[model samples]
Target chain A: MDLSAINPTLLLASLMVAATPLLLAAIGELVVERAGVLNLGVEGMMITGAICGFAIAVNTGSPILGLVAAALGGAVLSLLFAALTQYALANQVASGLALTLFGLGLSALIGQGYQGIKPPSFPKADIPLLSDIPFLGGVLFRHDFVVYLAIALTAVVWWVLKYSRIGLVLRAVGENHDAAHALGYKVVRIRVAAICFGGACAGLGGAYISLIRVPQWTEGMTAGIGWIALALVVFASWKPWRAMLGAYLFGGITVLQLNLQAAGVAIPVEYLAMSPYLITIIVLVIMSADKSRAPAALGRSFHASQ
Target chain B: MKLSKLLATAAVALGMATGAMAEDKTKVGFVFVGPIGDGGWTYEHNKGRLAVEQEFGDKVETVFVESVPEGPDAERVMTQMALEGADLIFTTSFGYMDPTINVAAKFPNVKFEHATGYKRADNVSTYSARFYEGRAIQGHIAGKMTKSNIVGYIGSYPIPEVIRGINSAFSHARKANPDVQFKIVWAYTWFDPAKEAEAAKVLIEQGADIILQHTDSTAPQAAAQEAGNVYTFGQASDMAEYGPKPRISSIIDDWAPYYIARTRAVMDGTWTSTDTWDGIGPGMVGIGEISSEVPADVKAEALALKDAIAKGEYHPFTGPLNKQDGSAWLAAGETADDGTLLGMNFYVEGIEGTIPQ
Candidate 1:
C-alpha cells in the first residue's frame, strides 16, 4: 500500500463536504433536545427538503431560492408534529415517527414530476486570498457557502450554549420542564421554536446534498445521514464543538476508507465500505460504555401537568 | 301536465351529456425505483417513456411516479395505476418483480412490462438486454490496455443481472491475458454518486488501472479522470464527454425501441407475455464509440470480439467455466441456461472476492 497515493488536502476537503449534512442536522437536533423536545423525524424532514429544494430550484432556476423553499418545506412538515405534541398532547416519540412517515409519502408525491431534471448548482465562494494560499486554499477556502455556514453555525451554537441566557433557560426547561413552566417560561412555545430550528437545519442539510454534493435530487439521497447526525449528537455528549469534531471524525473515516480502496490497498472492499458505520457504532459503544456522559433528559418526555 | 313532461325531458338530456363527456384516454403509468434524474439506469428508462409519448402523440397519455420504494409501496402504486385506468404500466426495477406478479394477478387486463425481471403472467412481460455482452467488450479493452493487471468493478447489487456482467467481464479478461485479476466493490445501491465515487477511488488505489461499474452514476468516470492514469467504462449512459483520459467506452441501455415496440404491439392487439433479451446485434444494448485514446491494435481486438458477439458467433459466458471455489459450473462447451443466469450467485474462477450474503 502506497501511503503517498492518498492526498491529505483532498481528503480533508471531501471530508468537509461529507460532514456538512451531518453537522447541519446534528446542530439542529441539539437545539431541539436542549429545549426538552425529542424529534426523530430528521430523515423525513431531510428528504422532504431534498424534493422541495429540487423542485423549486428547477422551477425558478435559482439555487438560493430553492434552499429557502426547502427550509420552509421542512419547517411546515415539522409543525404537524409540533401541533400534535403541543396542542393535542400526543406522545412525542410516536408523533415524531408519524411525521417521518408522512414526510416520506408527501415528498414522493411532490417529487414525481421533478425527477430526471437537473437543478442549478451552487457556485463556489472562493475566499480571494485564502483560496490562493497553496494547500490551505484548496482545503478551507474553496467550498460552497453552505459548508462555511455549517462551520459558522457550529461556533455560534457553541457560544450560545456556553454563554447566552436563552440557552440557560432552554437547558433549564430540558432538565426540569415542570419547574421551568412554573417560572412563567412557556414550555411548549420554547420546544416548538427549537423543533422548527431543527427542521430548518435538516432542510439545509438536505439542500446541501441536492445542490452541492450530488447536485441532483435522487430518492433517499440523504441515505441515513440524519441517523448518523443523531448518533453524532450522542457521540459528542450533546456539546456543539464536540458534535463538529465527531462529524469530521466520522467523515474522515469515510474519506480514508475510500482513499485506501483507490490507492490499491490490499483490503476487502466490503470491509472498507462498511468501516464508516462500524466505526460510528464503535464510538457510540465507547461513549456509552462508561455511562458518565449524556444529557439528563436526553430521551425523556416532559409533561407540564406533572 | 306540460310542466312535468318538460322536467322529465331535461333530466334525460343531462344524463346523456355527462356520459358523452366521460370518454377515457389511453392511460399509461410508470413505476420507478430510483429518482428519474439519477443520470444512469432510471434516467435512461424515463427517456424511453418520453419517447413513447413523442411517437404516439395524442393516441397515448403518460404519467409516472419516481422513487417508489420496492415492496408494499410498489404493489400499492401498481394497483392505484390499474384502478385509475392505466391500460399499460412499466415497473422499472428488478425488485419490483414479485409486486408486479402479485398486481398482475389482480389486473389481468392491464399490460405490465418489467425491466430486468424474469417472472411473467398473462399480462406481464419481462425484458432486459444482454448487458454482459457490452461488459465483455470493456473487459477485452481493459485486459489489453491495462499497465496494471488489476481491474475494478463497482457493483450495485449482488443480483443475477449485475453478477452476470461481472462474470462475463472477468471471463473475457482472463481469456485475453492469463494474469488479469478483478477487484470487486459492492456499493449496495443503484445510484449514490458519493458512495460510487468512493468505491472507484478505493479500487484505483488498490492498483486497478481499469474500472467498470454496474451502478447508475457518472461518478466512476469522474473519479477515474481525477486519478489521471486510470480508465473506466460508462454504465447505462454514453459518458464519453468524461472519457478518453478515463472513460473509453460505455454500455448504453437503449430502451426507446423496446418501449416503442411494446406500445405498438398493444395498439396492434398482438401483445403477449414473453421474456425478451436482446444485445448489440439488435441495438438494445448500445456499445458507445470506442475513444481515440485506445491503442489502434487494442481497439481492433476489442471490435473483433464485439463483431463476433453481435453476429452470434461468440458467447461471453461459454463453457469450461468454474465457480470461484474451483468447482466446475458448466460442462465443456456448454453455455449457461437463462434460468441459471437469472439466479446467478456464484463468482467465476478469476474473481478474488466473495459475494456477500
Candidate 2:
C-alpha cells in the first residue's frame, strides 16, 4: 500500500465538502429540538429539498434560485408536521415519522423526469489572499458557498442559543413549554417558527448535496445522512459548534476510508467502510459525557388549556 | 328455499368464469433493487420488463415494485405477487438469489428468474450477462488512453461478479500497458450516487486518470466530466449524455431479448430450472458506441476485441495468469471454466489488495 498517495490536504478539503450537508441539516434540527420539538423527518426534508432544488436549478439555470426553492419546499413540508404535532395535538414521534415517509414519496413523485440531469455548476469561493496560504488555504479556503454558510450557520446557532433572547425563548419552550407559555410567549407560534427554520436549514443542506456534492439528481440520493445528522445532534449534546465538529469528524472518516481503500491500505475494507459511523459515535459519545441532556419538554405537545 | 339455492349456483358459476379469464392473461411480476430511473442497472432491467410487455401486449400483465430491499422484503414481495396470481416473477439482483429460491419453493406454480445469481430451485432459474467481456475491451482502451498509468476501479461489493470484472479489466490493461497499476476502492453499494461520486473524486485525486465503476449510477460519469481529462465508462446502461469525452464508451446490459424469451418460455410451458450465462456472443452484453474521443486506432482495436469476444475467438480469462499470491491460476493458453469464474474469490496477480472477505 502506498500511503503517500493519500494527500492530507485534499482529504481535508473534500471532508469539508462532505460534511457541509450534514452540518446544515444537524444545525437546523438542533434549533428545532432546542425549541422542544423533535422532528425525525430530516431525511425526508433533505430529500425533498434535494429534488426541489434540483428541479428549479435545472429549469431556471440558477443554483441560487434552486437553493431558495429548496428551503421553501422544506419549510412547506414542515408546516404539515407543525399542523399535526402543534395544532392537531398529534404525537410528535408519529407525525415526524409520517413526515419522512410522506417526503420520500413526494420527492419521488416530483423527481419523475428529473433523474440523470445535472444541475448548473456552483463555483468555488477561492478567498483572495487566504486561499493562497500554503497548506491551510488548500484545506480550508477552497470550497463552495454552502460549506462556509454551514459553518456560519452553526456559529449563528451557537450565539443565538448562548446569548440571544429569541434563543432563550426557544430554549425555554424546549425546556418547559408550559412555563414558556405562562411567561406570555406564544408557545405554538415559537415552536412553529423554529420548526420552519429547521426545515429551511434541512432544505439548504439537501440542496448542498444535489447542487454541489453529487451535482445530480437520483432517488434516495441523500441515503441515510439525515438519520446520521439526527444521531450527531444528540451526540453533540445539542451544541451547534460540537455538531460542526462531529460532522467534520464523520465526514473526514468517510472520505478517509475511501482514500485508504483507493491507496490499497492493508486494513480490512469492511472495517474501514464502517469506521465513519463507528468512530464518530465513539468520539461524540465521549465528548458528550454526562454534562448534557435532551430538552425536558422535547417531543411533548403543548396546548394553552393543557 | 328453491330460489335461494338457484341464486347460490349462479354466484358460483360467475366466480368460476372470472377465474378462467384471469388465468388467460399471464401475470409477470418484477422486483427491482433500485429505482427504474437509476440510469444504470435497474434501468436496463426495467427496459427488459417493458420489452416483455411490448412483446405480449394484452396476453401478459406486468407488475413491478422498484427499489425493493433484497432480504425478507424481497421474499415478501415475491410471495405477495404469487398470491396475486402472478405466473412468473423476475427478481433482478444478486442479493435476491436466496429470496427468490425460498419464494419459488412456496409457490410451486410460479416461475422465478433471478439475475446475477447462482442459486436455483425446480421452479427458479438463474440468468446473468457476461459483462467481463466488455470490461476487457474497456481495459484495453483505458490502458491505451491513461497517461498517469493509474487506473481506478470503483467496486460495488466483493461478490464474484464484480471481482471477475476487476481481474479481467486489470489483466487486459496490463497487457496493453505494462506499467499500468490498478487502484481499487469498494463503495459497497449498488446505487448510492453521492457515495459513488465521492469514490470517483477520491480516485481522481489519487492520480487515477481512468475510472471504472461497478456501481449503478451516472454520478461517476459526472465526476469524471467535471474533473476534465479523466475518463470513465458507462455501466449497465448507455449514458450517452456524458459521452464524447469522459464516457468514451460503455458496457450496456441488453436483457430485453432474454427477458422476452423467458417470458415466451413460460407461455409455452417450456420454462424449467436453468442457468443461463451469456456473453457478447448472444448479444446479452453490448459494448455501447465508442465515442470519437477515443483515437481511431484505439477505437478500431477496441472494436476488434469486442468482435473477437463476440465471435468466441477470444476468452477474456484465457491463459498464463497467476493469483494475487503469485500462485498459478491458469496454465498458458488455458481458458477459465464457468465454475471457477462463477465463484471467483481472489484477485489475479499484479492487481494489488485483497478482496474484502
lDDT of each: 0.82, 0.92
Model 1 chain A: weakest 10-residue lDDT segment is A291-300
| Residue A33 lDDT in candidate 1 | 80
Model 1 TM-score, 2 decimals = 0.74
Query: Per-residue CA lDDT of candidate 2, range B1-357, in tens?
Result: 999999999999998986787778999999999878789999999999999999999899899998788789999988999998999899999999999989888899899999999998899999999999999999999999999999999999899999999999999999999999999999988988889999999999999999999999888998898889899999999888888779999999999999899999999999888999999999999999999988999999999999999999999999899999999999999999999999999999999988999
How far out, in Å, is residue B4 in model 2? 32
As for candidate 1, its clashing pairs are: A116-B37, A261-B202, A262-B201, A262-B202, A262-B204, A262-B205, A263-B205, A263-B206, A264-B205, A264-B206
Candidate 2 lDDT, tens digit per residue, A1-306? 889998999999999999999999999999999999999999999999999999999999999999999999999999999999999999999999999889888998999988767689998889989999999999999888789988889888999999999899999999999899999999999999999999999998999888899888888788788998999999999999889999999988889999999998999999999998899889988988877999999999999998
DockQ for candidate 2, please give it: 0.63
Best by lDDT: 2
TM-score of each: 0.74, 0.94
Clashing pairs in 2: none
- Residue B72, candidate 2: how far off, in angstroms? 3.2
